[model samples]
Target: MKELEERIRREGAILSETVLKVDSFLNHQVDTELALATGREFARVFEGEKITKVLTIEASGIQFAMAAGIALGVPFVYAKKKKAVTQSDKVYVAPVHSFTRGETYQVSVDQRYLNAGDRVLIVDDFLATGAALVGLVDIVEESGAELVGVGCIIEKSFQEGRGLLEAKGVRIHSLARIAAMKPGEVQFIEESGNRQLIEERA
Candidate 1:
């Protein structure tokens, strides 16, 4: 996690509208070492939880989610960005607005992937407006799956994502939390709790 935080500080690009572009190492080009380390960190953080499956939305979430699933020894399921033609009738769907693209779209997963008794951990590369995260949570609820927690690599703390999830009684573990980002500069929040742990490593 320390390494991740450092990477964000050193290499992360802050695009317009609160978007943190980590395409060099994440979000676009794959960094297997860092991705695997992130997965192991997530597994370590949520070790005691009875996680049956690792759930994540498709696109950016797939790499980190798959890495975490591998480390947790569980199957990883990705919700499609849109309803696929082969999607089953028994599926959970949610309409999510993309803050980055300025568009609304649907994401879904097969009902068979999640069930009433299963424990799920949602993983993703970043947390911005929390719209996608909310949609993922909705899918979990629709399938009657227990959402144990959410794990994210980089979270923009200035956004409402963390607050939204916390209001829903969901615990979020973000490796790096950017309090603010300006041109050529990024600030990480220094809260006394987990934030301190992240800062200590920095």
Candidate 2:
């Protein structure tokens, strides 16, 4: 994770107090090696849990979820941003507002992919607004899958996303937790706090 923090400090662009762009390496054009490392970290953190599947939202989160699935040796599933013509009618849906995109969309997952017997680990690229993560959590609840926890590549710790998920009893782990950020500076939360984060696992 220190490596991730270093990359962010060097390459991340902070447009404002609320916007941080990392598409250069983390998202749009990904660093394959680092992405795979993130997967291994999540697997190690959540080890011993009988994780049956890894879940994520479509587009950005796919790679990380796939990576985690590989590390955990389980299959992965992703919720489509919009329902496809071929998608099943019997699917769980939730409304998610993309703060960056400034719009909302209904994300859906096929009912057959998730069920009571599954233990799910929801993965994502960032945890800022928590809207998307919340939607995915709702779908997981609707499907009756036990949500082991959420794994995010990066997190804006100053945001409400963490509080919102914590209120719902969701455990979260983020590789780089930014306590604050501005146009030229980024502040990360101390690693000393992660022991509590890992211990609070559900």
> Which model scores highest in lDDT?
2
Instruction: Extract clashing residue pairs from model 2.
Output: none
lDDT of 2 by residue, 1-202 (tens): 9999999999999999979999988889999989999999999999999999999998999999999999999999999997788989999999999877899999999999999999999999999879999999999999999999999999988788988899999999999998878899998877678434423432
Off-target runs (Cα >4 Å) in candidate 1 are 191-202
lDDT (0-100) at residue 94 of candidate 2? 96
Query: Model 2: how far is 141 from its true place, Å?
Result: 0.5
The C-alpha stretches of model 2 lying farther than 4 A from their native spots are: 194-202
* Model 2 residue 89 lDDT score: 96
Error of 1 at 108 (Å): 0.6
| TM-score between model 1 and native | 0.92
Per-residue lDDT over 106-201 for candidate 1, one digit per residue giving the tens place of the 0 to 100 score = 888988889998999999988878999988988888888899999998888877888788898998998877877876788776534545533353
